[model samples]
Target: MTRPTALSVALSLSLPLAAHAAPDAAVVPDTTRDIDRVQVTATRTERAVSDVAATVDVIDREQMDRHLVQDLKDLVRYEPGLSVTSSATRFGLNGIRIRGLQGNRVRIQTDGIAMPTSFDIGAFSNANRNFTDLDTLKRVEIVRGPASSLYGSDALGGVVAFVTKDPADYLKDGKDSYVGLKFGYDGQWKGLLGGATGAFGGEHWSGLVNVNHRQGQETVNKGDVRVDNDRRTAPNPQDRDGRSVLAKLVYAPSDTQRFRLTAERNEDTTDTDVLSAISTAVPTPRAPLTSGMKAHDTQDRTRLSLAHEIDALDQPFADSLYWQVYTQNSQTRQQTDEKRTDGSRRHRVFSFDQRAYGLQAQLNKAFTTGSVDHALTYGFEGTRTEIRQKRDGYQVSSTGVVSTTVTPDAFPVRDFPITTTTELGLYAQDEMRLAGGKLSLVPGVRVDRYELKPDVDSIFAQDNPGLAVAQLKKTSVSPKLGMVWRFADQWSLFAGYAHGFRSPPYNDVNIGLTNVAFGYTAIANPDLKPETSDGYELGLRFIAPAAYVSLSGYYNDYKDFIESNVNTGRNAQGLIVFQSQNIADARIYGAEMKAGVEFGELSPALKGWALRSAVAWSRGDNRTDDEPLDSVDPLRGTLGLSYDADAWGVELAGTFVQRKKRLPPPAVQTNPNAPAASVYQPAGYGVLDLMAHWNFAPGATFNVGVFNLADKRYIEWSAITPGLITDRTLSDRFSSPGRTLSASLAVSW
Candidate 1:
């Protein structure tokens, strides 16, 4: 709990609500403008979140129905340096982490399409990037650092854009037609949710449809051993199902042209009994070499899109324009069933697939060059992707013989090959506005080209029998600069510098694996390189009307970075050689602060009270092994208190964590009796949550939440496992989740 005891427990829970909501005499009426929120992923356009200069976060749909949100770790659960990476053993949300980077280096998109690319191979493969479906989101944008100068190549640890729900967002007010319904329940995964939305319009047509479903189990843990080898942590029996569909169509023949068409689908399935991979000790302790396990996992995503928009164009290059053409398909499948105490049987299947086709375009202009006022933005993007992977298995002995030479796997393989990836990007941004606008300047640039091709079939030439599957091409350039200075009248000062890149993927340039009964061999690294970053930010803001404050600082530096597998030793048949390297040089530094207030603007007896707070701190380093970068995450804080009425609202929040003392140093116990490599530090915690909402009439609404409210059993340094140091008694299967409840109800017509 250090870091000054987590910054004095977040300043003793937000300094008495900021000294009892200071704001002395009449001034309130921001009405939660939230710094005039309008975000488009930090500069893909639409700015204003106090004029973006980095660091953005938005989660609308009324904060996902007042926080009854059920996925993406409850949508960032009070977001502090963002996180969402889960894996209670294979397939359970493995994506989204920023600042400490995460799989596929974080870039997820929904409406603008690009999602899928998270693959893990080994204990039966895992491919995840949960593929969006938060009740057909109507907003979610998070851009935190290094957005590859307008998103190119996974943005190198940032970007999460998702925006769906249009049909005029439910044909609002002058409502042509609309319908909505929702229901939900969640008790840490006793889940059940249902949703539907429909809309229709006229004046040149509009249409929308959305559907959702969910069912669940298995997300309970606070371990009570529960038998089953490895001293189980009570969460293995599982069954979860999910479904989603979204559709939209819009057209407007005039008044500045518009056309849109979209379709989406998402599916998720999970079934597991895996009693912690049952075991009874080895061939010596209890005569059991394994017994009973089951698993079935599936994830799917499909999308189709066509979009075009042009507004008031007077073309000198463009007045405004936007375009999209997309097609996407994603899949991940896993099946494993085993039972081997001797009456052997094992079956495995793992597949990861992706297919994409895309085109995107953007253009905008607002010229003036004599007195410096320009707001240009240009774009181009192209994509072609097809990635496929396969791993199949067989073994059925004891008396029913059938085997694909299973002793160390050999049955339909193809860990990498059949890869096709092509990408092209070109970008530009301007935004100048001089003194008359109180100083503002943004500059951006992007140029990217990446290609990788590998076909090599025959099941990857019968599993690495002479390997050589390499072809890659790369080019990149990213740049960014930003500044803002609205000196007074509510003050502001912002600064930024960014550049980020990530290429060299295609399963790490042709990765292949062969295990001679675990003697290990994983080889393929076709001179890989392209993981870079350089970021810097500085900020300060204060917007008043009822109060707002923000403070920030950041630093990032990375190069090559990409370390996977890594052993690189033993060859000549002694096996044990692994690769995938561009060895790592890194750095991360951070700070953040947030504040809000609204004590009825200071009168009317605290008109609807409000207070909010936030804090984050970070540090990471691995300068090529100088240690400590265990995916950095520690020091977090949040505090909230709210009350709103005109139709009810309530909130009480509190999250404070800082107890994962930067890991990575143990490991050096050359068997002095075995067992001593310690790593599992997770001890600081504080949790409290309680949400409420109730519009209850005219278009109904009712939401509820009560998370952790004192049942605290925390642990979420992105679900542990960094520098593992051996199981550590399963760490309660990566804890978190003790007191929980969620409720939702929504209706409209």
Candidate 2:
């Protein structure tokens, strides 16, 4: 027992929309710029990505379109320091892991509004990351380290903000209206998708709308094998469909003021036909066990927002200000129909709704006191969230038939109760210039207060004096500092320090229940401490007109890591379960480097040839328990070579992931006879990908890509690192898709 000191935890060149504001939804089709990609979230003000001291990555529209962006899951694969747990056949975004921390530790947002992070209740909670259409995004901004400096609370792991498209981005220069369309198909995913964007503008007003439709079949491993068993819960041949719409109206009343309103809706549904949706006839006394299952899962999300911005204020202290109000609502529903061993039908319906509303105001002022240039940004946010969940099952007749009338009180009570939470945040960042224009420093701080009050249903009481009780509230204040030194021409060094925190979630405190008759009980701990992390990073950047490169190293110290431990007790079900608790402290450290160079700039003989590469490696350990953090990302690298001509371009890309031996599986808490399954094995594999595209004209293009060119089958790290309790056997998990081909056509003007 010795604790390693804390610190924890890049891409590209020539990207269109490189200089777009972080929060101001990007507007563009395609155009390449030098090193001046502008971003606002880094400092709460407009600044190029090159000028920011902290690590920020921009996934431009060009890169996104090149990859045929599908969802958040698709976005994280190429980026370093981040991992998303979503399978190709999965319905919704599962979870995002950063710096070895998963779930609520990461913060997801669209524009400036916070998106709901995932939370599990009992053993039945579903993954929920509010929906967003990739077709509507201009770019994605990722802050790789602690972000509690600017955004409060859940910023412990980092931030992923989706920047959407706006009207001004699509309107033709000389025309009153503009329209764009895209269509694509992927054989691996069996996916067919189409999208359209239309915008119209007048002298002072602009309106835009984007619509997208997606449908797909389940992806499979080599030989088209469907790997569903009792443990994985996934049904082979899952069918999926998703539709999204985004509309916006923007008006500038005067040169100094502007107003905007936006409405967005996204809905997705997946259906699965299962052979064993329910457990079959068993040796136990409970006869007529469910033997087959079929389910339909659906998610619908809607957001309405209004914003007002003043470029310049009448008062001296308020140089510029912006404020907004927004409401977001989401619903997830699952319907399961099972056939019992005795040949009866059981219909189950489970649904949950989450509604959130918030108000935010930000103001910034710049002033000079002597030789130092100073800019200060201050903001406050207040948000309220309400959640309700209900579930019921009805019995049917013989031959696995139907039910027309409702069955009264046929199933168990609510699995999770109604809950409400209120969060308030205040933050400020000061960017000050020192040593003239050679050095810049940013000091920032944030305070967050979270209050939760749950109204548990009466189901908790077996007879009376149930385990329902109201408990704890938490608050945290974090401070951060960052500096950038432009010591040489086109070269700069940067370093930063930040404190991050995450308060205990509501469900963790209130989900206490027991079934004595069934032999299982899960008690909740109301007094849980918030998780905290100390992060430090140092890096360098070289920016030039024709090429760019960045290298960074980081370390992070984490305390009060949240985890649940299970005991050797049998419940009504044969398996053992656990409750949430603060188990241990951990540390993560790593280095990353990325570069893009166009050889034409240095040598004419290499004209039209460009090369890009990114490499990363990291390690983590549980300081208290003396074990390696299982989710640490292994050594990975990507290389690409491309040649661009007047009308056509071709590129060859390769990816390699090293086999990791770091974290061995700890003994399972359940029965030993069950045998160990997919532990932290982290099998390493590599594949080659190819892409070619033709630019038919300025506004039209056709692109084709072949993935997994070698047809090598491998399991991804994200899927199995976080093991599935739903698995009932000792077997392999889902494998990556096989060799697949896809082509897309995009047009804009």
Candidate 3:
């Protein structure tokens, strides 16, 4: 996993382009630079990004400040067949694996609603979703693979949207703008504030607030230093603190009415520690010296939208109409532990709260077709969800009290269970123009009907007894075909195909489970079925105005893929239960290539220099037990080189990940000491990152970075173990953190 010679391809085709090189519809309101006319909403409409045909990756805000990207798995790296995983306690047990199938099969959005809260609950791999907060992001669209025909049923490994900001475009010439901050070092401390506001009479407002703190220290592997019991544990050098807020308000009293308001809030707390399995020089009898794994999260969202451009609908079919309403509230508290013997210790706690609501409406118009040329659109949407869960368990000792206490009948208790879903969709799209305008075609179709209802809970209490209702209708008809062939004058070539569906998981009908094949207890399965996927893509672009290069390929096909099994023995409270199934198909295929060069002929000592790089490769499987698909990652790539002027700029990037061969699960084949282990393959590492940015004025800006850079020592996969180590730190693992450095300062006033 190290081959890019020829002097790194002539130093990546001789860097250049850090600014200047826009114009294709202009309108780019700085959200961290590095843009190529970016625009996308995964086809709900909003084109551009080379007229979409799929394969889109826009991380604007100037490449998230040259890659000091905070959160969302460092903004999916240079994205291209995404991959990210973490569990064993590390702030909400991170997870994301496009083209490889990740929990819930990828489907996250914002500004387009649709927050399903992991279907039937269960997925506290720490507490999913990890709510976003990159200072109220203004851009981030990764429509890679699969899209469930424009978003339906988790989209099967594809779709990630997070777009925000538009408070009248955050005023600038009338005043009101700001930024403030500190940075990372030693313990990775962090802090940054925000601001934006300008209109008063015509009514327009923008607001943002941010806070991120990190306490570093523990997280070592190939050099020891990773303790969890027997001392050393207190959020260890991995404590985190966060707070984010965004507010926007807009009003356009005339010119056909317009009003909008948005609000968002985020809170975070993540403590780490989960290493146990022995070693650090032995010591394993009555374990428990200290164990940890904690998480706390909070999310809040609000949105209201309205738009009009009527002249009595101008009578001609339609002119415009739009409406939106969104609401969200999420809360989670999680914990996990291990440290027993007699000294005692065994914990697991997860508390949940979720709420989601959405409503949407759309319309647009323009006409003509004979000689080609048109514009038309349509849409409809509705959504609702509510969930609440509480679980407490313990088995303490070693002076910790609580000998044992875990009941809700020891398992089964779905209290605040209320699921009432509704969705009805009807869509149409048209945008045709031919030769004269250099060619174009956009097709669309949507016919959705999703309904859910599963009240369950009746009396909640397990030992095997009670609710298992079942009913969550489904109906789909997704169709979208696209093409944009502009033969030159900025070149173009796009392609698309879509179809998605998902239903059957409203808590999977009261989640019944109580095994005991040979002795007693039995009850599981409540007619589960419903999960489909199909997504396609094609692309080729060379948009001018600066420079752009794109290439794409994607494929996905999944059907009834859900698994869980371990009907090994006991039950009736004796333990060992687990059953959940429905599997038989899965596939993911891929290819993605990106290139950017923005040299309006740099000279002034390499003016705002420009140069960019991207690379992606994918291969997913599980074609009904064909293997290779428990956590996919076969290749990942990134390359960057930069230098700019204006105030200051610097960037040097390099990242590559490859190596995966660990797949164990399926009830470990009845343990027999579980032989055949080493699929132990992890030997693809490349790290080198450095960044710097400065502006000091005009909305202010300052950023600094340094990550990895030679202090290398790898191991990011090998049968999970981000805590609960000991096989000599599991032959010492986890590594990937050193040579740290960070800095940031911002002001937009």
Per-candidate TM vs. native? 0.35, 0.89, 0.33
Error of 2 at 137 (Å): 0.7
Q: Model 3: per-residue lDDT, tens digit, 261-338?
A: 666666666555444332234435533333333333333333333322232356466776666766777777666565
The numbered model that scores best in TM-score is 2
- Candidate 2 TM-score over all chains jointly: 0.89
- lDDT string, candidate 2, 1-749, tens digits: 12111100000000001112423324443435323566676677888888888777777777677666676756765666677765333343576777666666777788788876564332123647747777778877777877876787788888877778877767655667988899998776689999998889888898999999999976555433334334442336678899999999989888777788989999988887653233422624344555667778888889999988888796787788888899999888877776666667777667778899999999888999899999888888889998777655677766545553222222444544577889898988898998878999999999999888877656434321355556568889999999999999989999999999888776566654443333444556677788888999999999886789888999999888765433435545563434567767888999988788888888889888888788878899887778877777778888888887877788888888887678644434345686665444546899888888788988898888888899886666766534442242322435676788888898887
Off by over 4 Å in 2: 1-36, 87-92, 121-125, 223-235, 275-290, 395-412, 457-465, 565-579, 672-680, 721-733
As a TM-score, model 3 comes out at: 0.33
lDDT of 1 by residue, 257-298 (tens): 778888999988999888876765665433336578888988
Which pairs in model 1 have colliding backbones? 28-601
Give the per-residue Cα lDDT of candidate 3 at 514.
34
Tell me how many residue pairs clash in candidate 1: 1
Least accurate stretch of 10 residues (summed lDDT) in model 3?
14-23
